[model samples]
Target: MSGNGERVVFVLDAPGDESLHTGGTIARLLDDGADVTVLFGSATSYDSDASAPTTASAGAADVAAARAALGETDPAQWRVLAGEPQGAQRRAVLGEAFAQAHATAVVAAAVDPALRQAAVDAAGEQGVPVFLSSRVSAVPGVRLTAIDVSDHIDKKLAALAAYPGRWRLDGRVVRLIDGTEALVTGTETYASGSGPAQPAELEAPTVGSRLLAVLMALFAGALFGVLGTVAHQTTIELGSLTIPVGLTLALLASGTLLLGLRLVVHDRLVVLAAAIGLVATVFLLSLRSTGGSVLVPAGVPGTVWSMAPALFAALVIAWPRIPARRPTA
Candidate 1:
């Protein structure tokens, strides 16, 4: 049943921001019991359902080099999904993979227009929700969802390393060490750390859970504040236009609130629900963009607003379903 979870599949042209759009989204999906399948043309993996984003390919020299790097066969960690010689045929292969994976949602990165169109077409036929990840857009769209996966950014960076020679993970990590290139989002206003942070080993860092949680929360909160500021500035230009809050800020605020409440409160689900409420509140409040703050709107009562979403979540948790409306003809 664990493996038989909702599948959130991404169809990519190759490895880049297009493929690595948000590691936190995938991480959150994994955490929330969702299966992720990344279908990329000329990628090196089988199934695309590996637990930890295991690496791929068919080139003799490339395979040998990869094997030499690992000092052994990768043991089918990578599987070839399809060969994109032409648009029509490629779409067919992707569609088949989606059916096989039982994909509940489909996301096509902004790489090839044809690829995205094929994805949209296939998803449309399946009557499933389809989305496109655009690096160009500064905000979310009616069809586009703004994903802020700052939480599992480390995992993302590590996964990029798994690709090898595709995007040169070294190139990515080298910039990350000084913080100017900041591979992940956080509260770090200035560079502080140095050395050995690049070309990530994907190895465990031994940071305690408590400390990690705190860091993640702070980063998310800082991200929220920054976005709020942007929203404020944008509003001044457009005459009170609401700036949509991205997903990362919500995650940061939610995680922070969750950890903070955990310090005193004991209910796991309840606390999580509460955190979601707070994050949701922060999300909406941030859209209003009242320069440099994550609090509820000035006139709105904080307690009621904060608890409302949690209370609704509690109700949902208890029932886990809502009755369908009956049409009276």
Candidate 2:
């Protein structure tokens, strides 16, 4: 038992004598004024003579006998729980019985291979201590230790240090300690490999840089808006129809792209890219405009002129500078 008021003890019993051991252990525990209960694997057979002492040959009658032997004047004090022959049912029964009885320790012989494994697994799951024995002893002082292959102590300590909170893997179960189903599935490898490099010093934008970028974008937008309005008012006629307004929209789009690049890369690359785009826009609008006229209203030529100022400003702000190294004496 841990320092948490839980009990820990060992019971002695033969491999096939779970019934006898269960009854005797319970009787001995009650006599010693210990608040503990005994868990016995269900018997496969039934007999009147065998029922008298709660042996493997005893059926439900043995449970009654065992309860009576425990001096359980109240029906709730001694409860007999029958476990399935194998699988999760058996594990649950043993765990449930141990919890209900408030048994700080358990004493039972290693009987069935399946049961033995189930007991160990369930105890591990519940953080309960189990004691295995091979001989049925009427004595309660028989020393026993649970052989646990799953070294849970170390695993539990490591988990607590890594993630200090209640973690659930299956969405239903809480992984309190090590070897629990939740811990096995949820815990991940920490030292798998290295990660991507941290961004460079230039990439780390200061408050001033961010504010300046925002102001630049706003100023560029306002300048382009004025240019667009001016181009719209002065409709330049080409052949029979007026020039398309899409030219100004294109310039605005190019300026927005440049500002985005500046925000991301934070260097002269943005300015160079934006200047190239702006020059290309102007050339394309010039070629497409009526008679290659720059005065065409609502046309590409007028739009390029309107966007020129903002595009130049973006270039200037996005330009990169070389850092000065300190002089060593």
Q: Give the alpha carbon lDDT tens digit for every residue of 215-326 in model 1.
A: 5544544454344333322222246674333333433443455555454433344444454534454456545444665544443333333443355444433543232232
> Which candidate ranks first by lDDT, i.e. highest?
1
List TM-scores for all candidates, in order.
0.40, 0.31
Instruction: Mark the 10 consecutive residues where model 2 has the least summed lDDT.
Output: 187-196
Best by TM-score: 1
Candidate 2 lDDT tens digits, 216-267: 6445544444444435334458889975455556455555656655655555
lDDT of 1 at 44: 37
- Model 2 — TM-score against the truth? 0.31
| Regions of candidate 1 where Cα sits further than 4 Å from its true position | 1-4, 15-19, 44-78, 136-144, 163-183, 186-329
